[model samples]
Target: MKSRYIIASITGVSLSLMGIVGAQAYSGENLAKHAKITMTEAQGIALKARPGTITDEELEKEKGGSGLRYSFDIKGTDKVVYEVGVDAQTGSVLENDKESSHPD
Candidate 1:
């Protein structure tokens, strides 16, 4: 009886640990499992926010001490390069600043 109890306890603990791991894996915070917005969606949002053509884009989990966002470098027809950030969760523009004459 004691051996059966011990085995049951171990199984319970293992199941609990597996649940925790699975929860973490599926959490919205983990981009690999939950992507609120795709790269194409992010690019579209950035282009709309900056009114420019996206020349470069990257998925940023944490940038400059900020939360998950998509960074985009855009060049308008006027030749001004702009830096833009789209929130990964809400697909909103977080930052849009002119990044010198050079592109990032």
Candidate 2:
């Protein structure tokens, strides 16, 4: 009986970890909406910043509250990667910090 319980616990932990990993993979409508901006606009903004290659984009929830924000990853001219954030509702650029990356 003890062995059976240990096996069940291990299975449960493994399943929980899998759930976390899946959640981190970026699959959802909110994220899709944010990433759906026109490629022209994205390239225009990206050109100004001169972040090398655009990698990925997603919609992120605000930290202190409920709204949404758009974030994109870009390989910089200096060879370092960086993230950019824009307000989803107002279309205003918010922050360029890496910590701005998050799920909605």
Candidate 3:
């Protein structure tokens, strides 16, 4: 009985860990079908345009970049945050500007 309990506990923990990992890996997965460019590709493009560590990222439908864009907020080596938007369909850099003091 004790061994069975231990096995069940282990299984529960493993499932919980998998859920957390899956969540992180698929942040914008729902919007993926609408994007021609993959998230990994967008990340590379965003980094090149801003040259910083990505603090936050998401695939959102905004008023640019084929109406579907991958947005990234990167913290520069100089400690400033920049918002870079990449067109999901064309892989073009749509916006690369300093993040405003008041973010939307």
Candidate 4:
């Protein structure tokens, strides 16, 4: 009985960790339900506005179009980091600008 309980506990922990890892695909996924444009569509819009390799992306609420936007941090081929914001509801490019370097 003790061994069975231990095995069950380990299995539960493993499953929980797996869930967390899987959820890392996107931040603010909870807000996805309110978004008219899917994440894939937003990505395309952002890339078209400013071509680059996306380093980070998230859906967030802010004072903007529909109050919700998909923000992407893209590293350009020139090595500059650019922040692109796309409206979650309309798929419009809200912001496309170079990212300022912050002091550590």
Top TM-score hit: 4
- Candidate 3 global lDDT: 0.89
lDDT of 2 by residue, 1-104 (tens): 99999999999999999987866554233354554444345444644554577677666676622266656677677766677665555555565654344331
lDDT of 3 by residue, 1-104 (tens): 99999999999999999988876554577889989999999999999988989988998889965999998889988888999999999999999988996253
Residue pairs clashing in model 1 are none
Q: Which lDDT values do the candidates have, in the order given?
A: 0.76, 0.59, 0.89, 0.91
- Give the per-residue lDDT of model 4 (tens digit) for 8-104: 9999999999998987678898899999999999999999999989988999999988999999998887888899999999999999988876221
Model 4 clash tally, residue pairs: 0
Candidate 2 Cα misplacement greater than 4 A, ranges: 1-28, 31-47, 64-66, 98-104
Once superposed on the true structure, which residue ranges of model 3 sit more than 4 Å away at CA? 24-26, 101-104
User: Cα deviation in Å at residue 56, candidate 3?
Assistant: 0.8
Worst 10 residues of 3 by lDDT: 20-29
Ranking according to TM-score, highest score first: 4, 3, 1, 2
Name the weakest run of 10 consecutive residues (lDDT summed) in model 4.
95-104
Deviation from native of the Cα of residue 99 in model 1, angstroms: 1.0
RMSD for each of the candidates: 10.1, 8.2, 2.7, 2.3
- The best-first sequence of candidates by lDDT reads 4, 3, 1, 2
